[model samples]
Each structure stands twice: as C-alpha cells, then as structure tokens.
Target chain A: MSSPVTTKPFETTGPGKQVLEITDLKVSFPGLFKTVQAVRSIDLNIGVGEIHGLVGESGSGKSITAMSCLGLLPDSAVVEGSVKVTGHEINGTPEKQLARLRGGGAAMIFQNPMKALNPFFSVGQQMFDVIRCHRDLSKNEIRAEAEKALQAVQLPDPHLALKKYPHQMSGGQLQRVVIAMALACRPRLLIADEPTTALDVTVQAQIITLLRALARDHDLAILFITHDLGVVASLCDRVSVMYAGEVVESGSVGDLFANPSHPYTRKLMSTVPKLGLGEQSLDFIPGQVPDMSSPPAGCAFNPRCDMATDACLQPANKVLVVSKDTDVSGKHWAACHHVTGKKPSSETALSETLEEHNA
Target chain B: MSHLDQPADLLVVNKLHKTFTTKNGVMTAIDNLSFDVKAGETVALVGESGCGKSTVATCLLGLQSSDSGEIVVEGRNLLADSKAQGKSLGRDLGIVFQNPYASLNPKMKIKAIIAEPLKTAFRLRGVELQQRIIELLAHVGLGEEHMDRYPHEFSGGQRQRIAIARALAMESKLLILDEPTAALDVSVQAQVLQLLKQLQSENGLSYLFISHDLATVEFLAQRVLVMYLGRIVEAGTVAQVFKSPRHPYTRTLLDSVPSIDPARRDELKTLGGEIPSPLNRPVGCHFAPRCPRASDRCHKDVPQEITEQGHRFSCHHPINAAEE
Candidate 1:
C-alpha cells in the first residue's frame, strides 16, 4: 500500500513562526475510471496562536487537507505536497514516525465526539490510554493529568465525568471530553474539523469560546475546518475560502468579510442568513459544486460565478487584493481574474431575480 | 364545516400534550403546546435538540398521536377522528425531514417517489401522474431530466429539492419542513430556502418550519414559536422575537448565535448549561437551569404566559423592552 514519497527541505520564515505549513498540496484518489482530484495546489500557513479557517462547501477538499496534515489519508490517495506540522514533514513520514508525531505535535477533534470515543470504555480509561500512548506517565499521574485536562475544559465534576461512558455525557460534555483528550498531549497544533457543528448553537458558542481561549493560552495554532461562514467570522483570525478543491480567497477575517475579492467568496458570504438582517432575499450560487473526477476547466467556480468572463476559462493566479507593498502577514489574496479590492455593489443579479420572482 | 367555510388558520395545535413511558419514567415530550399556522404563512418552531420541535412535527403529520388536546386542520380536528380523517389529512399535510439523503428512498427514481403520495391520496396514474410529478419538480427549480435519477445520483441540495417536490406531490396546502436545509451548505441552503419561498408564494402554501437555526428562522418565518422542554416559551412575529427578545432563554439563544460580522468576534454570550433532560422534569421553568436572568421565582414557580400586542412569553424576569 506504499505510495511514492517526495521530500523537501524545511525552511523557517517570519517572527510569528508557523506551526503548520502546507505548500503546493495536491491530493487525488485514483479510481478504476478516473482520478478524483480532491485537492489542487493549496497553500496555507498557520502561525502560533492563530486560528485559520478553511471554509468551503462539502467536497471542496477541506477534510482531505486536514487528513493530509496527519498523514491519515487512505492508502489509495495520491498525495503530492509538503504538509509540515510543527516543522516536521508529514507527506512521506513513516507510519511509526507519523503515529509518534500525531498526538504529540498535532491533534484533531472531529465533528462528532461520540464517534471519536469508544462506547465501551469509560472516559477515564480512554484518557489514560491516550495520555499513556503519548507519555510514560504512572497510573496516578495519568489520572491526575486527565482530571486536570477535564478541569481545563471547565467540565463540571471532572471526577464523576471520567467514570462515565461516552453515552452518559451530553453532546457538549462529550465534545469537551474529546477536546480535553486532544489537548492532553499539549500539541502545538489542533485541527478542529467542524468540532461544533453537531452541537446546539448555545453549546457551539461555548466550544468556540473555549477553542479561542485554548489557542491564546497555549499559543497553539488551530486549523478550524467548517462550512459555517458565521463560525469562521467569529472564531478565525484569518480565513481561506475553498471552492471545488482550490482556494479562491485568503485574507484576514475582517478583510475578507468586509471586501470579499473572489465572486465565490462574495456569493458565499451573501448566502449566509445574517442574524439581524432579516427578510432580505439571500443570494445563492446557481450551479452545484463541480464533480471532482471531471471538474470544470480553469476556475472551478466559473460555471456558477456571475462575474466570470472568457478570461476566467484560463486558470487565475493568486493576486494580492491590496497593493504588493503591503506587509506579508496583512496581505489579502484572491485567485480570480477579477480581484477587485472593493465589495460588490448592493444591486446584483440575484436581487434582480428576487424582484422578478416577487413580481 | 364544508370546504367553502374553511378557517383562516390552516393548522391549529391547542394544548397538545404527549408523553412517552420510558424505562425510567413517563417523559413529557410536548407539554400543553399551542401554536397555529395561518393560511399561506410560515410559522417556525425553533429550539435546540431534544426541545420537542420534531415531536410537534410528528404529531402534526399524524405519525404520532398526542395524549390529549386537539390538532385542528382546516376546521376539522385531527384528534377527533384520526382514523377516519387520516386520508384527507395526508392530502393536506406533507413533511420533509432533516436529512434529505435518509428521507428520500435511494432505490426509487424521482418520478416514482413523487408519485407515491399522488397515487395514494389522489389515485393519479399514467400521463396525469407523470405531468404532476414534472410540475412539482419544476416548482422546486428542478427539471424533468432529473425524474429518472435516483436519490443517490443527486447532491444534497438537489436531493432536498427532490424531497420538497415529493412533499408537494399531493398539492398539500401545509408543509412540515423539519430542518429541511440543516444538512446543506450555506450556499445550497440559501438555494433551497429561496425555492421554498418561491413554492410558498406560487402555491399559497403554509409551512411549519421547524429548526434550531435562528437566522434561517428569522429569514423564512413570518412568526416564530420558541420551544423549551416541550413548552412554547415564547411566541411572536419574527421582528418582535428577534429584535427585542423578552424571555431570558430567547435572549440567550439569540445572543449565542455567532454573528457573521467579524467585528463581533469573541462577543458570544454563551448559555452556561446544556438543556435539561425531559425525563428529570425540572420544577417550574425548564429554562431556569440555563437562563442567565433566571430569578428565584423562576426556579420556585412556573411563570404565567404574558401577552402583549401579539407577542407572548413566559419569563419570571423578562428582559426589558427598552434594552436591545
């Protein structure tokens, strides 16, 4: 099941120091008929204490990108890129070595905490096993560490909580336990793949706040993957908008939200039902996400993008939304031929459609 | 009453009570719940999981019967003659579930799936049934080309559209959309929502929109019923409920939603605790355990429903109307 391995020399840059750096990542699954291009040349970097949101519709290669970071992709996956976690190359890392790096350097919390935990085992047993696998701690020490981790997550009655099975705890409590287990190893990077999506909004807010606090307190870099634009807006310092395998836009959350450069990003932001902005007709991307096996040519979003022109048929380069002279960290980028720094006008084609529909 | 003398209210649920006898004890699923959907109106029943939102839908759909109270639809009480009125009720009501993938039959083609209700309720067959299926699909923004395709062949949004088409197959005046777009992406969700709006306007459909997403509820619903532990804690027009939420639980629920505005980062006023189990049966207000503004009275005695200009809420310590 061994795939061809590629290696690249590690290079460090900037004072913030990156915890996870993905460069020129391309992931594909070779099938009987055709190869499914899941990820196409994605470049992402998350610095210490920064929460970078990887947002996209389903089948946009978000989960694939996250899995590649941990070298957890299926054996059939043809991964070609540099996915470095805590300065360690993950693409061609040996299985034993990858296992060692997983919980120690980077830990991932999934959407469903119950599925992540073993139903048969008590929380204490699972926590002890995970802690023991990462560190050579005594039973008492492990139990103490587990209690401390649970306490850190603000789980009331940590002692009682550890004795309970996954089924016994509520959805929010189970999520906290899962988070505690992930952070027990004190990983430098946390890849939260829709961690709060399953929980209620009230519970989700608590988890979001907890994640933000954890990142700041531990100086941990987080890669928060979700389709929720609102969650990204609230939780992330920076965001990268993915569409059909390629990142169409990347910038500081404020910059992207205020002036989304890519048509996909703009349309996506507009689609989300804003809390106070009630009753306004929401804009929607017309066409479906491209089939990965035989994706549309050039910009994947061209089929659904209203602003697309003949030039959009050719692959667009990642152009800086601001002038090139801007600071590297503050620079905003959009992979579109028409990367206007300004926001789209209020009167768009969608509003026209709404008016026509109303008539 | 005759068909010509139909009431303005499409569906009226009055003091609906449903309880399940579990291994532990009898758990009240819907406790004296009352709400109404007017003709061609969208009344959203919003609450977190285990708040009996789905129970209301099930009861309305006649999948489950309530222990007491009346479910009156179009001047006929469904509870009065559930067995006799079931067939007609099926024609009047249609349901689209939360997960489109699971709700739709994968083995069946779009045409056949949509034809089921038409066949059972109207006994439509041959070209007429085919035409009706196509028409329903067209109404949902899907085309006739999709009729032969299976549920698995369509994406989530497309599948949801198909589900909506099937729900509309019987020319149902009232649709029970139970988290119809919860499983979809934001972009796709917007598409489905827009389609729903279009369908509602075009057909003069009433919708019992059940969801936990407040933003979506506000967008689609003319009125909203905020449920907690099977009780309607608050009920009002979308503007009144969302803009000036009176109940502490309603305020908490509204505040917990992470604003899409990036400037409001880290501003989430999260509720402290999870929803209490219905089996436990908290004394007094069910939301008191999680409500930030819960007073001693809230824990000691249930607050009476207070009504003001069509807005209603049960809160011991309501947030002042002056406060935003």
Candidate 2:
C-alpha cells in the first residue's frame, strides 16, 4: 500500500509508431449446417505503453479479435487479415515460429486463473519452464527473476507461493501468479481477457492498479478485453465498442463516455448503475445479439438500434467523418450510415435526440 | 431496535444460530441473526461469497435445520409440531438458487417442472394442472409454446423467468431469490429485474432478495442487511445505507466498485488480504483485520448493533456520528 505507483496521464499516441496493428481482420467458421461469421473486417492500432480496451457483450467478437492477434484460432476458423506485433506479422506464420513468438513476443492472460494454471505442477516449476523456453538462464538466475516477477505484482511470501500448487492459493493470489507468469518472458504486447471478472471487487481494484503500473513502468502495449465498461473507463486510454462482429464506435475514453454516438454504445453505457445515484430502473437495450450464422443484412445493429432509418437496411461501410463542436480526434468515428458525412449543424434534430444522457 | 410492540407479518426469524464442526474446529456460520419481512416488501441480504446468507435462506425454506431458531410464518412456528411434520410449510416458502441449470430438472418438460410443486401440494391434476401451468408461464412473461421446451432450450433470461414461474406456482407469500441475475448479462439482468418488479406488484408477494450486486439491491429492495463474516453489520433503508454508509466494511465495498465516469473515480483504498477463513476467524469483530479505522476495542470486543433514526449499524466508529 505504501509503494509509489503513479500512472501516466492518458494521451493519444502519435501516429507512425504503432506497437500492435491489425487491418481488415475477418474470421469465419464454415460448418456443415451454417457458417458462423464470428469477426467481420475490423482494424485497430495500439502504441507502446498504451492500454487499449475492446468491450462488448457475449458473442460480440471481442475475444476472437484478440485471439487472432496470437494466431490461436482453431483450424476450422478462416482468418484473413494482417496481425503485426512489434512490427512483425503474426498471422499466416508456421506453428513452430508462432510458438516461439507467443511467449517471447506476446503473452495472453485468460479469465479463469485456476483453469489457466496447470494443477499438477507447482507454481515455480511452471514458471521456470516458461522462462527457460524464452531465455537461456541458469537455475539460480531463473529463480531470482521469477521471484522478482512475483514481488513486482505485490504477492506476499513469494518463495512460499512458488512451492504451493495452484489449488492451494486463493483466487486473488492465483491471478497474481498468472500475471507473473505472463510477465516472466517480458513480452512487448500483453492481451488480458477479462482478467479481473472472476475476482472480488477489492481484488479487482488491486489488479487494475497493478496493470496500470505495468503499462507505465515496462512500456508494454496492452489489449484489455472485457464486457464491463466501468473497468474500461478506469483502466483504458482508448476504447473500441463492438456489436455483432463490428466495431460500432472507437474513440478516446473521455470522448466516448461524454458524447457517445452509436446507439449500442449509448444504451450499453446506460445499463451500468452509478454508485451514489438514487434508486432508478436501468435502461436496457431490447433483444440480444443476433445469431452469427444468419445475421441480418445491412448494419448488424440496425434491428436493435433506436435510431435506425429506412436507409439503414442497406449495406454500410466504415467511415471517419468528423463531428462538429467536439474534441474528437479524426480517428474517433462510428460506423453508421445515418451519422456519416452529415455535419451536426444540418442534422441537429437527430443529433439532439441522440445526445440524450451519456450516463 | 424492538419489534415487540408491532404485529408480526408474513415471516419472522429470531435468534437464529448455526455452527459446523469441521476439521479446523467449531465454525459459527450464523451468529444470533434476526430479521423480519412484511407482507409485500423486499428485504435484501447483501454480503460477499460466504457470509451465511444462503444458510439463512435454507433454514427458512426448511431445507436445512438451524441449530436453534424460532421461525414463525403467519402466526405459526414453523419449527413446531403437527403441520410441520410433513414439511407442509414448504407451500408458504419457495427458494430460487443462483444457478438455474442446477436447480431445474433437465429431463422434465417445462410443464411438469412448474406443475411439480402444485401436484404435490394441492393435488391439481389433468386439465386443471395444464391450465395452471400455462397461466403461470404467461404470468412470468413466457408463453404456452414454451410449455413443452426443456430447461436447456431457453436462453438464460427465459430460464430464470421459468424458475420464477415455478417459485410462484404454489401461491407462496415469501420467495428467496439468491443472486438471480448474477449469471446473466447486464442488459438481460435489467429485463429480469423489471419482470420481478412487475410480478411483485401484481401478486403482492414478499421477497427475501440475496445478492452481492449493490446496484440491483438498491433498485429492488426496500431494506438492506449488510453481512460480514457471519453477522449483520448494517441494516437500514436503501437510501440511508447507500447514501451515507456507516460501517467501515460497507464503505470499503462501496468504494471498491468501479465507476463508469472517470471524473467520479475516487482514490481506491482496496482492502488488503482476503476474507479470513471462517474456521480460523479472528476474535471480536470479524471485519477488524480489514477495517482501516479498527481500534484495539474492535479486536477485543464485538461491537453491539447501534441504532439511530431507523438506521442500525455495528461498528466501533460509525461514519457521520457527529452530524447525527
């Protein structure tokens, strides 16, 4: 509690020095019955020392997009995209090279810590194996580095924890161990998928603080995947809101929270209850994410969006139209045919109604 | 602090105590717990993972016997003779667990599942039973078409609605809902909560809502009982407790919740260490180890519940005491 952990202020990364970049990423599972289009064409870029968030409900393709970066999708998946980590292409690489690049180049932490860690091996044994795979260090050197990683995450009794099995540790302690293992190789890019969803509120806060510090001190680029927008606001600098396999909106966290444009983003933000606010029924979006196999034509969110027009039934493409009277960077945009290319001055009626309440 | 002057309503539990002798030693799961639910009110039991909230529910439903308690329902002691001999009290109390997949029987049709309680309790058979099942389905926002569907066929929200319909089959006055919406997504959770509210108003049914989600508790419950370890640490109306939480543990929990607005993000002072093992609990206040304002008195003597302006809290140093 006394450690001096200061998070760097959030600022947009300058162009031309991206640490992780994805372009036109599309993943589909062709089955005998029907084809499940998991992820449509999408793009993303994260600079070094930045924490970028991918947030959506279940079956929103956020997890699959992250999996594509690691080339971990199953063989049945038809992936067509370019995934570059530290300026090296990861997709279409052979299994041997991908295995080598996985830990040393990039690492991923999953949701369930107990299931992620092997039950048979001690924590130290599994951690040493990862270190040995990435670096050629002596036994003493490896143990020292592992202890350092454990201590960096603020776990108590680092040496004793190494001797215990995964089942012997608490949920919070096990998560710290998983984080330590992920950081053992010092991978440049880290993909954490709902790492704190299974933890208690207090433990989640601690882990969030740790992640922020890691991004600052290690200069590591992170792709944080979660369904909770509250955690995204507190942790991420920039965010991408996905709905039914498409990025409906992408912008800085402040801009998105203040003036959300997409109907799904606005409705999703309203679902989260404020802590000090009085008792009020939450406003929830109607219906669920459509079945991936037979998605509707035109916009995927057109069926559920309240602002859908007659033109919304036709196909729409991505665009980066500039909004009026807002501090939105040119990259901050939404994929809606209704809002595209229309300045706020002319479309004041629709913009005013959609302005509503961001919360 | 005294309910002696008021008339008892639907459910009243007094001095409930439960303990287990495990490999570690004697562990007190419920320590002198007491609460009352009116005819049409929602009383929420808020706590973390293992705070004996579920144990209290089980005891009330007669699924598990308490070590010693006086559970009275509608002017009759549920722990006493005659009618209690055959567990007929179950007709008055119904409970829904966290996981619908486990609580529901997968082999049976939705019709048979909802009719199971009615068949055993009232012996309504044949056409009458079928009509009643369909009526229950409609009451919970489902339709007659879902009557033949199995538990696995419906979505999570639809399954929970079916579970609610089953709980209301016997015209039970009090329903115990344990984390009913925890497993569902946020938007779907709102839908279920709205349905619960609608049902409560229509049937005038009382609910003993148990959940760890504070926002849902604030929306649904008229009163809240905050539990730490195995004891009630705070009890008050939603406005009283949520606006100005008195206990240190309650304050910590509220602060730990992440806010969606970055400007409202307070400096988070997370509690160190996990909840102490129930078997090897610390002396005096169970929350003393984690409470930042805990004094030597908190570690030595259990603080008695203090009441002011209908707000009751157990703490050595309650917040906003000077203002009061």
Q: What's the distance in Å from true for residue A27, model 2?
A: 1.7
Q: Using lDDT as the measure, which candidate wins?
A: 1
| TM-score for all models, in order of appearance | 0.91, 0.88
Q: Candidate 2, residues A237-283: lDDT per residue as tens digits?
A: 78899988888888777666765777788888887766667768788
DockQ of each: 0.51, 0.40
Candidate 1 — what's its lDDT?
0.85
lDDT of 1 by residue, B67-124 (tens): 9998888888888986745864578888898878798888899888999988988899
CAPRI classification of candidate 1: medium
Q: At residue B243, what lDDT does model 1 achieve?
A: 92
Among these predictions, the greatest TM-score belongs to 1
Off by over 4 Å in 2: A1-17, A319-326, A340-359, B1-8, B80-90, B104-171, B321-324
Write candidate 1's Cα lDDT for A1-359 as tens digits.
01111111122245436798888899999999999999999888887777889999988999999999999999999999898888899998899999999899999999989799999999999999999999999999999999999999999999999999999888999999999999999999999999998889999999988988887788878899999988987888888999888898887777677667789988998899888877698998887788899998898889988988999999986665653223332347688988764322433633343223212
